[model samples]
Target: MELWFTEEHTKDVRFTIRVDEQIESVQSDFQKIDVFQTPEFGKVLVIDGYIMLTEKDEFVYHEMITHVPMSVNPNIKKILVIGAGDGGTVRELTRYNTVERIDMVEIDKMVVDVCVDHIPQTACKLSHEKVNLYFEDGLKFVKTKENEYDLIIVDSTDPVGPGMELFTVDFYENCFKALKEDGILVNQHESPYYAREAAAMQRAHEKIKKVFPVAKVYQAHIPTYGSGHWLFGFASKKYDPINHMDEEAWNKLLIKTKYYNSALHKGAFALPNYVLEMLEQNI
Candidate 1:
């Protein structure tokens, strides 16, 4: 018999992948964690039956989330990452030599430990000298800080379970307060292709727009994520992702990326008409 893993994207829809081997399975304080190996996606990390990342296409997500804001503001020295327990977000952020300090607050330390042992590709840089890992609630962590970080990335899961508070308006306000005067915030905005995900996406955008001077949504295609069309939220105090993007300066840095590029940076913000309509409905 063959073992396969399935994640229900909706009541009637499911995604199934063949599992080559089960590496580890544990019940953490927050969620169920599983690591598996597959022929196609390489190593896979699943949390609460949801596919978090795979070695094959993880670059698309980690790069898009980190590079977009970094390219927009090359001077981002201090960064706070919320809920990225897998450490892929931190790995990408570590590539920027200009970044001086990284404060990563992950609610579940088991996710980090499992990823470090089974998925080293994404978790390799979690121990970088500049990184300070905190196994605490990100919501309460942000509430205690003010005008400290130049960039804040909320690399959280779906707005459910431990991630629920991270999407609330109060959390967005706390993130806004935690940022410096010219700070930028990039977060995992839910997808717009499905009804449930679209509703969450709209609510997040509406709330962030109310708190930040500039708020925009950009997208990337991650095959494992629901509907293969994932969106990221970009909210800033002053800089605009497109207008402030220094293509020449970014290119001069000679950073090699698989998904994010200067051209894609501008094109990503071109939301589809239907997505635009959805956002407009909330406005």
Candidate 2:
């Protein structure tokens, strides 16, 4: 018998990966966490049967989320990250010497523990000096903050279970209030390839647009995610991701990346016509 891990992308579509063995599986207070070893993707982290990250292509999602805002405003020193329990986001942000403090709010502590025990590659930087971990609700965490952080990254899961509130208008409003003047907000916007997912993507964009002065969507290709095409939300009070990008200064940092660069940073925001129409028409 062959061991495999399968995820249902939709009612009719499913993705399966050949698994060598199950390394760990523990039921956390929030959700079920599992780690598996695979030939194609190496070590994989699963939350509630959803693929969170894999050692093989984790760089693409983590790097794009961190570098896109960092390149636009290299002076950003204080960052507030929500729901990034895997520590991949912090790992990339800690690479910047200029980033002084990172306050990460995660609702599930077991998710962090499981990742640290099984996938040390991404979880290594969770203990860095600049990082401060707070295991609480991200929605409530931002509510207590007011114009403090220079950047805020909403590295949340899909709009369900523990992450559903992160997509609401109230949460986005609190996020806007928690950022300093000219601060930036980036989030894991859902994919636009499927009907259900696309509806959620459009809803999130609409809510952010109501709160922030500038709101835009960007794209990235991550194979494990549904449809292999994912989107991210970029909202800011003052700076424009394209016009204000400090490409020269960012390049000077000499930060080596596997999937992100200055060129791709500018091109990611250039969405396809259908996606553009969906955003404009609210379809």
Residue-wise lDDT of candidate 2 within 1-283, one digit each (tens)? 6999999899899999999999999998888889999999999999899999999999999999999999999999999999999999999999999999999999999999998888999999999999999999999999999999999999998998898999999999999999999899999999999887899999999999999999999999999998999999999999999999999999999999999999999999999999998887754
Collision pairs in model 1:
none
* Candidate 1, backbone clash total: 0
In Å, residue 59's CA in model 1 sits off its true spot by 0.6
* Model 2 worst lDDT run, 10 consecutive residues: 274-283
* Stretches of candidate 2 exceeding 4 Å from the true structure: none
What's the TM-score of each model vs. the native?
0.99, 0.99
lDDT of 1 by residue, 13-62 (tens): 99999999999999999999999999889999999989999999999999
Candidate 2 TM-score over all chains jointly: 0.99
For candidate 1, the per-residue lDDT at 57 reads 96
- Model 1 misplacement above 4 A: none
